[model samples]
Target: MKKLSLLILSLGVLFSCQSASSKTEPENNPEIKMEENKTMQQDVTKKKNRIVVFETTMGKIKAELFEDKAPITTNNFITLTEKGYYNNLIFHRVIPNFMIQGGCPEGTGRGGPGYAIKDEFGPGLKHDKAGILSMANAGPNTGGSQFFITTVPTPWLDGKHAIFGQVIEGLDVVLKISEVERNKMDRPLKDVIMTKVYIVNE
Candidate 1:
């Protein structure tokens, strides 16, 4: 009788251990699967999103556009840049220690994309300082591809220019280009064109 009882206890312990191990294994498996799914989702999102590159006459500037934050602004820029609309467009206005404005197909400050996009603001983006690319418009809701790059902090433009992308490289190029001669309106006396604009991923 004692031997039989001992055998039953051993079987009970073995089954209990197996049950515990099985339960723990399922819990860990689900967690691992959830993590894998999350990573896959992130990778898919990144792959779908594109990184835009602006090859200016001064130099190349890269910007990782935020589609999720400013979808309308980002999409507008992507469409315009991809269509070669910005190519050869002159930096019409360049104010010392202020900002440089462009996006006129005719290389004049009065040109535009022929259509306007609704303002996408309050995304925590700010036009605080230099290298911050933003929209150029006569008034709110009038932005139509005309944009600017700051040479210095233009506090007055904080809420004016719709903060889109920023210059991630070759900022000195803008400063040097701005030093070029300009008319009374700060428009470049001699046209400084953006040779070509393209998108590149790093």
Candidate 2:
């Protein structure tokens, strides 16, 4: 009877040990829980803002695309950037106290990707200040790869152009290009090339 009692007690102890081990395993451990939370937070951070980095000859200009507000315009720009279409494009037009225009493959304000995108305008979007990025269109619904960044407040353009994005980090670079020497047509005397444009925060 004593031997039987001893065997039952040992079995109970073994079972208890396994239960404790299982409870403290990696899946249930506090350290693992913290790591999972950290990873989740990192992912959430990435989805908050969509960033685009433009590597220009003057300097790098980082713009935050308004994806929620201008989905078509923002995505179109993102697509062009991913396709390497803006590489080597010069800032073909730069008017002081106004804006700098580019993304013309011909560098003469006459070239585009051979196709135009519909205007994605909406309420509350306006070209009210510097750094505002909007399509350089010939008329209504004529948006294409060509875009401009304002160097000063341009309220007249408000409610006329589709304000798709803005210069979040390099407004100074845009203003600097606006000050470059230009001809009668406002084309830069020397090329202020956009070496590349790419999406960030992937």
Candidate 3:
């Protein structure tokens, strides 16, 4: 009986040591570990989202384009940008330290892409600061080629418009444009033309 009990304890200890050894072994194959990590990181980054680069005549302006959250607004913007629709349009309205409106075919802040788009608004975005670029519209569900860049917070415009992107560079140029002399309605004394529009990889 004593011999049997000792043998059982030895077997239990051996099994326990084997389990502990297995616990110490690495599950991942070291040869492919780095490659797998890189692939996963890329997948996550691809879904992490990116912004659009608006190479303007004034300067290069980077904008965080909204796509996942604002599909319609983003699609419209992408369509226009891809087609070079914004080239040569002037920022017709310049309210100093307030907002700069454009996207008018006539560069008069009264034109569009000959069609309107539905408005998409929600949380996590606001017009409560400067350098914010948003879609310009006549009324609800009437947004099109028109868009504006804010120079100051316009809280009143929030929830009533769709913010497609925001300036990430050359805001000083925006400020300079804002300082342009204005007419009675705060429109620019002269046109702040966007001579060209091109894309850059984000």
Candidate 4:
């Protein structure tokens, strides 16, 4: 009887230690730790990005500004939108299967908000797909209120332009605008105006 009691006590301690070890194994696992870190980064990115809605004459377009990736360019765009600077602005330049350029208050692609901002480029940001929102600049570091939304991947403009945001909804509307009739300068034959622009903190 004494021997049996001692054996039972030993087994209990062994099982208890095994259970404790298993509980802590995941906390020490490198793979699990990496996954946890990745999830944290994703949450941070979600909090940083801002949603913007563009109510154009053609249709409504929704976009997400990559504030973390392009702080300067995103700030400039958000500031302008908050100030109603994009209201009534026309998509001055349009090309089928290419891009639609706008945000020139002058409606002639020669105006700005009385200032220019430095260019921002990142490895993760690129004109790799349609609906990419990028700064329209004449040369390096000349970005201002002018911007464009690509209707197709424009890899050539990757480092040349600052990618600030991407259209999440209303891409068909962008495609429609791109197919509109334009003149010699690629300006839309009839105005495709941005009736209203707003920002959502989420």
Q: What is candidate 4's local distance difference test score?
A: 0.92
Best by TM-score: 1
- The alpha-carbon lDDT assigned to residue 114 of candidate 4 equals 87
Residue 196 lDDT (model 1): 84
Give the Cα error of residue 26 in candidate 1, in Å: 0.6
**Model 4 clash tally?**
0
Q: Indicate whether candidate 2 or candidate 4 has the larger lDDT.
A: 4
Better of 3 and 4 by lDDT: 4
Task: Specify the poorest-scoring 10-residue window by lDDT in model 2.
Answer: 23-32
Over 24-125, each residue of candidate 1 has an lDDT whose tens digit, in order, gives 664557888999999999898676546666677667766667666778988899889888888777888888887888888766677788888887674778
Question: What CA root-mean-square deviation does each model show from the true structure?
Answer: 3.7, 5.4, 4.3, 6.1
Q: What lDDT does candidate 1 reach at residue 91?
A: 85
Candidate 2 lDDT tens digits, 23-67:
877665798889999999998886665888889999999888888
Q: For residues 1-202, what per-residue lDDT tens digits would candidate 3 score against the true structure? A: 9999999999999999999999999897886998989999988777644566655456666677766678788888778877989888888887776877777888777778888888898558899888888988878999998888898899999889898777877778888887888889777776677777655546
For residues 1-202, could you state the per-residue lDDT of candidate 4 as single tens digits?
A: 9999999999999999999998877456798889999999998866778898999999999999988888889989999999999988999999998999999988999999988899899659989999999999999999999999999999999899999999999999999999999999999889999999999976
Q: How accurate is candidate 2 locally (lDDT)?
A: 0.88
- Which residue segments of model 3 deviate by more than 4 Å? 1-27, 48-50, 53-58
Q: What are the runs in model 1 whose C-alpha is more than 4 Å off?
A: 1-38, 41-51
Clashing pairs in 3: none
Between the candidate structures 1 and 4, which one is better when assessed by lDDT? 4
Give the range of the ten consecutive residues with the poorest summed lDDT in model 3.
48-57
lDDT per model vs. reference? 0.80, 0.88, 0.79, 0.92
